[model samples]
Target: MVARRRRGAADADQYKPEAHSSDGAVVYVRVQEDGEFVITDDDGQPYDETELRVLRKYAGEGMRDMLQQACDRLNADLSALATVHCDTLSPRDKPAFQSRAFPEPEPQRNPLLQPTLWSRIWPPARRRLEEQNERRAEQYTRAFSEWEEAARAFNEQERQRREQETELVLTNLDAMANILEEHLGEIPWPRETSVSFDLGDDASTIAIDIELPEEDAFPDVEYTLAAKQPKVSVKKIAATRRRMLYRDYAHGVAMRVLGEIYHRLPTVQVALISAYVPTLDTGTGQPTENYLYSVLVTKSQWREINFKALANIEPPATLERFELRRKMTKTGVFKAIEPFDVEALANEVGI
Candidate 1:
């Protein structure tokens, strides 16, 4: 039985094979051509032939079976990793919109006190004092009224801002599109990719169009050597062999965009993703032409799929729900595959 090599052990000899037993004992096993067995315990120290002979004499016959069983158990554990369930949910900070604080209005106070008895003795003085007090009271009342109006306006502005932040709006859709573009731009690709979101009147459904790099930007297959030997040439892969690789790449990109939209934006229920590659037109032989591939999937439908398990499946098999069209190419001529119409889907859903 084969076992993993033990770490941090001293080199006992240059010729013997070292191994660990099931009981955590490290030993070296050697077979002689004359049908003799040599075994020695390793105690992080070197042992001569005399010490080895003593160790072999004391070693139990049952130790070999024990080590074999341990190795079998380790292999069994490793093989179970393929279908193991994992929690892959990633937590992100919820988006927040803050409103600026409005300035507080100054206090409006009474400008006059009680009239004095001396002022009351003269009618003109008393009248003048009473008129001054009336004027001051009017100014105070007017100032209070202006402050109340300012407070009401501030409150209304805050209410509208809060609604814009939480509810869907066309202006907010532009902001969301900008965010999608910024995120897609960060992908490690040759071209600057972007995505635009168009929200419908229904609010739950969103149409997305993503710009993808040219197909030529991706290599068909990578060359590699079968063995690490001198003067060995690397194996060349056929173009047909790499077809699945390109399909899988496109599939992964679509899934990533879907995850970002449905999970990050909780308001979105159904997302229709259209990915297009800008390349030279085959018919006109002109640059800056597009070949598009589109898929429509609901958030509920995607949530039912096991993403981890689906990762191992072929792209076409995993993306069967999209009803994706197949591209056709023949002898340097290419035909574009039309995607499902987003407007028709919206109308069917009564959006």
Candidate 2:
């Protein structure tokens, strides 16, 4: 057998979006562009642009993939939960009723032993044996009846439990969220993070808010040898290069989300995903935000595109079928887009 190697911390730390969770807790979403797509958490803090660099580091993957994974985990957990305790009922002790006849007093045993001690003893002893047998037969009959009753109750409980589980799967949104939370809770992270989901009417449409790390998290740096000495320094990246990377990352996140959602919830044709970055508005000392990326797409239209064929697709490329609103300036700042119209998207997808 080949030896298996253990994974290192760096390898284990590869970006994994938090599993989709539906606890009522707020989910803060910060996009990298302008302040267009910001969802405040329970803290009621406003968006801050200066903090954007920090917020981009821990951004999670789209909810669709997370949810799909959660569903798989839930199915496994439910399968385990669905198992009923087996009732190992031993077979009841059945009495074999055979004909038992008493000897006729042994014919006075050699006639000379008339009125001997054993003659009196044998008659009484036989009577006692007959009585003991009757008692035991009654006891066995009651034990069998008790065993049958227990078996019936066990079966009835198991049937009801199965029906309840089926209903939970069909209609319990809370249960789904809880399962997602449980699944996500297993991932490793340096800090505590939470996931929350919003469902449109009839689960037909969905929106997700994922908190992400700041811009500083992605360092543009390299290790080098200068003057025969090893050194590390920051690498200056071009605006276009950085822009492309940011856009690609955002798009990748969206595609991952959309793809996973389509896989598990094909019925939900419309989806809106927004990434938010926290930063401080240089002018105001308070925190602000940039809309890193957002996309609205329908499964019906997206279903046709072979995502794997294209080497690279930006966020705008996916919005060809519908309307989009975003602000971009020459200074490398991106403004947020207008609020997405779920109803319009839902209708467009013919949901």
Best candidate (score: TM-score): 1
Cα lDDT of model 1 by residue, 241-262, tens digit: 3443344444555665676565
Candidates in order, TM-scores: namely 0.45, 0.42
> In model 2, what lDDT does residue 76 have?
31
Q: What C-alpha lDDT do the candidate models reach, one value each?
A: 0.51, 0.42
**Candidate 2 TM-score, C-alpha based:** 0.42
Error of 1 at 343 (Å): 1.0
Q: Which tens-of-lDDT digit does each residue in 119-208 have in candidate 2?
A: 457987655655666666666667666666766666675564444333342344443333334333443322222233455444456665
